[model samples]
Target: MLRCHEVTIQVPGRVVCDHLSVVFEAGQVWAVLGRNGAGKSTLIHTLAGLARPAAGSVELQSTDESARGARARARIVGVLLQIEDGTYWGTVAEYVLLGRFPHSHPLMGYSRDDIEHAEAALDALALTTYAGQRFATLSGGERQRVRIAQIIAQRPRLFLLDEPLQHLDLAHQARVLDLIATRAREHGAAAVMVLHEPLWITRSCTHVLVLAGDGTAHCGPADEVLTRERLEHAYGCRLREVDYGAGRSFVPDV
Candidate 1:
């Protein structure tokens, strides 16, 4: 499990999220839902260890109390950020191979197992044919797929993805989320992702964490916290939650 205790985050002069606490357990897909500038990305960065919390501690279940939690998180969490600003320099396969850095050796080099894992991840994200293509040359959506493939190659116990479906089309969005869902179940890992699309969250997540302004959360099972009332309260606007079982969807209340 991945947990945050009394976590607070602040920017230069503003307290974005305050005293936030949440737990992500194995066999659960969690959606961190909120509106723009609600500190959703900040929370994800904190959990990923890319940004330090103003005050709080993050813990991984398997580690000792005295163990360095930051280092442990780095090893156990595979993160996908909201943006990829810097240009990538390598091929899709090479970029995916980078995920094995924590386990690779200079002299021994990348093993066959590592190559197989990277290849499998590429295949999973439907980027196999683009394996040899330059990362910088792919379209934005295609690049996002490669990024997801890299994280899949990492095979971490905790997955933190920030707005992972932003640039993806309907088909790729479902495919990618399904891929993450399958991997999390197969490995008994915890998957926590931030999303703006209510329909996707309702359909893809087992647990949902709704973030309101000033750092409040209404978190629970998908069917509970994803209701019209809760979503309107969280996003400060009305919403309509629709159910279609296998093909569930949601729309703006207004």
Candidate 2:
């Protein structure tokens, strides 16, 4: 649903990617893998229209993303930043309810449907029990889950998630991945997530983008781009591949 046309992303002194052209289709989950400072987050921000690319352009559903207004863009794109600096003193439910802002009528306030959506999102992330709790009082992982719930409540066509697995335990991480992948498959949504773990890509991702930290990248179906040699080159390390009943797993050879 989203296409990058010869997009070039740079951060300060470093070039993240140059002339990177790729399409993220509906019903697909894409994993963006790169080591630290590789500009993965920068690439995501550029796609979300939160940052400007150095060259080329991005399109959402064939229209120029920059030409769209903020509210118009919000209706189609949901973005989860790697770091959320804003502080919300409201309750968990109230915080998540904000996600429905794009759909809610400003003068009419939140509708019953909006509340239901927020509640369902909270439940999906296993945060229904904490709905009444204060958002500022939650643990790190709980807060991360809440952030994800907020995005789910938005119900946008495209999900741009940066470091989505941050601060979560293994179980929660698995649940989050499954939830995103299932939503993309069932609702015809598209998700581009910045992830550090390659094993999760084997589990849920349909496509992979590997940034080599030198303004070069590889993008293709997960099976084609997630090979041991490519990952080793992109990550600049040796990775040992092991096969299990479920799928393959990669670990540091050292």
Give lDDT per model, in order.
0.82, 0.93
Q: Write candidate 2's Cα lDDT for 1-254 as tens digits.
A: 88899999988999899999999999999999999999999999999998899999998883545537787789789999999988799999999999999889989999999999999999999999999999999999999999999999999989999999999999999999999998899998899999988789999999999999999999999998888998888889999998866998799999
**Tens digits of lDDT, candidate 1, 1-254:** 87889888886655766787778899899999887887889888888778889998876676545435544445578999888786678899999998766556657988998899999999988999999999999998999988898888988878899988878989999998988788678878889999888778877789998778666776788877777777787778766667777766668767
**Candidate 2 global CA lDDT score:** 0.93
Candidate 1 clash pair list: none
> Which window of 10 residues has the lowest lDDT sum in candidate 2?
62-71
TM-score of each predicted structure versus truth: 0.91, 0.96
TM-score for candidate 1, residues paired by index: 0.91
lDDT of 1 at 47: 82
